[model samples]
Target: MRPILRIFLSLTVLLACVMPHAHASVANAPGANLEVALVTYGPGDVYWERFGHDALELRDTVSGEAVNFNYGVFDFNEKNFFLNFARGRMHYLMDAEPTGDEEGYYVQVGRSITRQRLALTPAQAAALRDFLFWNLRPENAGYNYDYYVDNCTTRVRDALDKALGGIIKAHLAAQAGGMSYRQQTDRLMSAQPWLMLLLDLGLGPYADQPMNAWSESFLPYELQANLRRIRVPDGHGGTQPLVQDEQLLSPNRLSVPPAQAPDLRRPLGAAGLAFALLLVATARRARRVHALLATLYLIAAGLAGLLLLVLWTLTSHHSAWANANLLLFSPLAFLLLRTSWRARRGLAPTRFANGVVVLQLLAALAAVLLHLLPGTVQQNQPWILFALPVWLALAWSLRQAAPPASFAGAASARG
Candidate 1:
């Protein structure tokens, strides 16, 4: 295979290898019930034009007057607007900052998705299924720290719990933010049984320790017993924690044992800190390995940006064709730019590297900022989060892509 093909294949293989471990984490959790919500926005002249495309025509439902067809400028803006709104709702649900203007708009919308997900039509369910399948595939989805944090899982679970809909008021009441994270955890104690089970399974690395539900804080532990079936230390000397998977009794599956709820806060937090420190040390030591590290980080950042964009598009319930096209092509171009830069510059590529990393970090922050702005200000404007891809590409390309094979030779030649 060609060198470029080799690089691509290697990355692909690494992802594939890691996914089994990732999915193993999910195995204990109940599969999500497909529930979705579709909301429409009107009363703007430019709304239909921007979002309408490929047989989409906005018409006055009462008068039957056609306003726009196959995506006009207004439709585009409207789509972007709803996405911004949905993002705000997402923030509210997750106990993060809201981006929408009126506090009422954000809260009402969260209530609405919760409501709609409960009372979804067959058509809506089908649309959600299609949307999720296409987007949630390992190739399409990005693995960010948040992915491990379970934002997507939480969002999907919230929607489905609404769909199961026992006491509507009770479910919504349980999900409302503004109370402390601990309050939310107390709610979860009574809220979603599946999530609680998943929390207890300790399938993935995060599960190996106790996670504080309210603050969403992870506390790492010194002792292994507090966690679900961790690889216990053997009496004999061994450096690594041993692998042990002992299944616990379930409330539904077996007789309920009056057991103390595991406090994993310390161990989980410690693990996260350790993992984080390890990365920091690796990065510092691997300054010579900057190119490879940059490449990996770039790929990660690119996928993360794309996933966020897709979620933005879907929640807005707009035609994502244009945005999706941009999403895929943008990263490819960024990679190509990096390849070209590396091919030309030998031994030194620090200027481009600094420019790229700083730019990507800024763009990511900007996306979050835009997500916090009010819906009215964003209604006509395109969501700013999409801009991060450009920075991501630049950073990925500029970072030392590979170790200079002959640093000594280059220095000798210069001498």
Candidate 2:
């Protein structure tokens, strides 16, 4: 159960690219009463749902059968599900179900659902319906899913663009939104500090690229908001809002997701400074205890570096590649583990180990220097504030430090 929970939670957060799809020709859909609407579900309580979800709804008022076409459905029991997800090849599909079937569940969970009546013409509505029905077919339904580029919200946006003759892309694709993928991710993951920190430590420069509105609409809220401002040509002549009417079916029971990223400077900075001070004080008073604590810290740093390294080299997680964090939380830190263990046993750390510490300290210094350079936008200040002081303290303590047992006897030996 724990493993499954971790798999799904990580899966939801590791969001991705557009893949090609096979589509059948548009068939004739029901004539006049085909109503097309966009239904958006707000962020839910579960970690997997922090990003929210959305679907396209096509209703035939004549037949009274309203089907919601959702592209967010994934099967947990699918073969190689975990493996494929780990390799960044997640498979999601469009599911067409009765609209009424989902409302009850969302309402019970206290998640908000908003329905936007679209002003699409009959022809546009019919075309979209045909495409969605075609998508319902087994071969056409499944798609290669990615987080930021090809998730539920992006899929809905693509379909709307197809029906609207590409207006959404044309207007929003190149228009700068002044936000990056990381900023948006930070905002959504703010409530979960651990996840936010995990992502911050792993993500590389790729996540720092600024997003345009089209790319930013991967969020359901962004898509829903953007829909209001879009203008589609009315049947007569003039332009009209793409959203004809808006109705909120249910209210959000959970707190609204934060709009901005959390500022970690104060907390992380204080913690780092305090920890560094503790290490320095312990080095003066209790060399053995300081050695044990530093050894533990080194082991943890090595393991985290290992995970980040694997994500970069062995996996297809593009966002985690080329991370500058390797400087601060390095797998190379493992080299000092044996030295610290020796120190804990009253033996002195080797000169080579002290040299390694100096190298690590220099590398950490370089990380900040490079970030200060122009065009390098990793947004790693929080991590720098947390890691730099520790590395600096470690360097200071490791150099020319007497063995644990020798510290107390040094005064007598000198006498």
Candidate 3:
């Protein structure tokens, strides 16, 4: 009975040793048909889904098995996930799974899926499959995620470029169409006005520069569209289309609603109304109302300026740097709040208060002149238009309020 048990255990060990080689041999067997495709998913309603997603699909015709290589997976429970995300050091990992498992999630979320079958030779298809499997290994799976440069779509593009020995990039360059990063983002995000506003504020001139075909491939849908036009060398001195066939696997039912046009007039009108009230307050010597408005505006502007300062100096957000909006939303506004409160109490105007009013006027003027400068390309006109008149009105109201005679006499003596 012991000899029989030992013989069974030895056979089990032998089978384990032989199984992997057997599977590899079968997978690469001659005459085995293989297909490689790019699977792209349409954007969903969520903020994170606004960019869409893409993956590679490899189908083994002989085994009738379809595998999906996805590079978009990230664990929320990963060490320092949220912290790293804030620091612009988020990590994403590759995930290889059965095609059905991957498709199920996108289908459930109602995002449209499109597949573009690549016209790769058997050797090329095999190489891509091997490369994807190698990349799926734990050591090679993780990558630093950059939204515009090194995200999921770009990963798939780079992988295909690698498999094709730079042929894909060569084709893309030869047939490149120009589009700036900001233009493409704005077009996609046009359905979300608040998001568009935030992005416009956050992104710098780097996003405004024109993108090459390779840079544009960061977008999944753009890659899908460009793949149709790509022509690769056929090894026989002729070119063949990169995409052999294209199919729409699913239609997006959760369409993003169109963005409502920004009402620039409404904000301008509101500012105008506030200015009118400020004029009336100054005329009637309504120190309390004037002080209240000044304090509120100063506090709001101070906070906004501080946030922009942090985004510029303390973070890895490139787009928020060199913001001219700081000129309009000056942090120095906060320093004047004490004087505003003093005025509300009918106290004599201090020299510091007078200086702050002059500084506010100068800041407003600087904001207006910012757009005319060579490198200040931020579209802060709406903010400038809204806040400039309010600053001027506040300045005028402060000047209209006379200081006590005794305080003025003391100030004159000091001067």
Strongest candidate by lDDT: 2
Q: Number of clashing pairs, model 2?
A: 3
lDDT of 3 at 26: 21
Error of 2 at 78 (Å): 1.9
Candidate 3, residues 18-76, lDDT tens digits: the string is 46643432235332377889999988776777878899988767666676777887777
Off by over 4 Å in 1: 1-251, 254-290, 314-346, 350-355, 365-415
TM-scores for all predictions: 0.26, 0.89, 0.79
**Ranking of models by lDDT:** 2, 3, 1
For candidate 1, write residues 213-234 as lDDT tens digits. Answer: 3213111110112222222223
In terms of TM-score, the best-performing candidate is 2
Task: Report backbone clashes per prediction.
Answer: 42, 3, 0
Tell me how many residue pairs clash in candidate 1: 42
TM-score of 3: 0.79
Q: Model 1, 194: alpha-carbon shift in Å?
A: 15
